[model samples]
Target: MRPLAPSFAALACLALFSAPALAHFQEVIPSADVLPEGGEVNIDMVFTHPFEGGPVMEMKKPVKMGVFKAGTTTDLLPRIKQSEIDGKTTWSLETELVEPGASIFYVEPQPYWEPAEGKYIIHYAKVVVDNYASGEGWDELVGLPVEIQPLTRPTGLWAGNVFSGVVLKEGNPVPFAEIEVEFINDASITAPNDAFITQVIKADANGTFTYAMPRAGWWGFAALVEGDEPMSSPEGKDVPVELGALMWVKTTDMSGK
Candidate 1:
């Protein structure tokens, strides 16, 4: 179904609307696994928020992995997109990190496809049922995983333009390495990362910045090239991320300025 490069036309008018495909994501899956026997567990799929006041998480599908074997039937493998930026709406699947031993992972599903409820909450979330259910890992007495719930459907945030910045290298200021911005809200920042607040801005002094998310639904933003220092996670898996995954931007006329 590859027919969208007419320059994308504002993501093909938000993919021919009618609504029913909301999403928000964040699934790292390691849950303290120390499987030394056949040793092979290193899932790294991140996109977190709740206001990444010290951020760094950029996603564009390529973190493929879905191995649910034992009798076989769940091996949705696909990964390898490399890089993406400039009027976004990406997905290039064909991944397989191959480690089909003690499996149970279904990573990769959130890039326009919602229907959990309606109204947009976190960017794109889907992974409940104990996160994937298996042995409960590292011995918590086994019985903990499925609890990924937050998809109040009704998406279509940036019907036209979006892009925000702050990622330097030779000029400094590269905190968390991922600045894909373009918001429009005009000095009213407060939607830290319910993932779809649309626009919110701040950053200056050669670091550069911009914002204008005056009202849109699905949105995107990620930063933290390890600059501006601040990072944490390890308190109960430290889950408090609001924004999930809504990265797509660059469509002009932003309504008026």
Candidate 2:
């Protein structure tokens, strides 16, 4: 009898990418960041296949990374909990049966980042994320409440949504405020979602407003201009506006409240 060898595609995928490049029980990449106080963290994990020669291969596969509030069995917020961990800050999602590729994780900003940002720590271990050509993989987990607690301070936000905010001009709320936002994947700039953005929203009669949001990404407030003019608020001129999809901007003094 003859022993089986390997194929070009099989070898190309490499076992490392399929397994998060982590050891039998160790972390490969531990990331952290500076976050606002009292914010939640939403983690986004992406998988890529690295090659021995040439560049790393990007694989768009069905991988799940879930988060559970310190202690509970309820469905995690992002509900991608394919990996099970010991406590709140400890977890390992699997890319099992993966075709030898790499994975990326982005812990989005909440109201703050102290929870899992630079303060907490994470260890890596591989788990199996099953896949089926048929769509029967749905958990049918439904709305069963399992009593999950919110992390005193969690990390990550909606994967690619933008947080809306407003500025004012001459003691008046600026309607057509132009803002710049950058979409990022892990550390790379993702394809922009400007096409999905809506027109400027207005403040209510009370000088208050609710803003719209784009999916989720690394966002930076570019400018606050209305119809080609920059806006000014009593607080000061254009200030640094960095918001995640779950944050809100307050324009109090300019609203004449």
Question: lDDT by residue for model 1 over 1-257, one digit each (tens)?
Answer: 97756667776777667442322334333322223333334443444332232122355563344544444445444442333323332333232323323333445443322223322122322221222223232111111121111121111124443334443443345333333333323344565554443233444564545545444322344332321222233332312222222222222234532
lDDT tens digits by residue: candidate 2, 1-257: 88788887887677534543210111112222212221223333322111111122222222223322212222233544333232223232322222211112222211111221122111121111112212222122111111111111112334323233333333344444343322222433332442322233444443333333343323222232222232333345532222211111111122232
Error of 1 at 158 (Å): 13
Query: For model 2, what is the alpha-carbon lDDT of residue 107?
Result: 27
TM-score against native, each model: 0.22, 0.21
Q: Which candidate has the highest lDDT of all?
A: 1
Please give the distance, in angstroms, between residue 178's alpha carbon in candidate 1 and its true position after superposition: 28
Q: Which stretches of candidate 1 lie over 4 Å from their true place?
A: 1-46, 57-74, 82-144, 148-215, 219-257
Question: Model 2, 249: alpha-carbon shift in Å?
Answer: 10
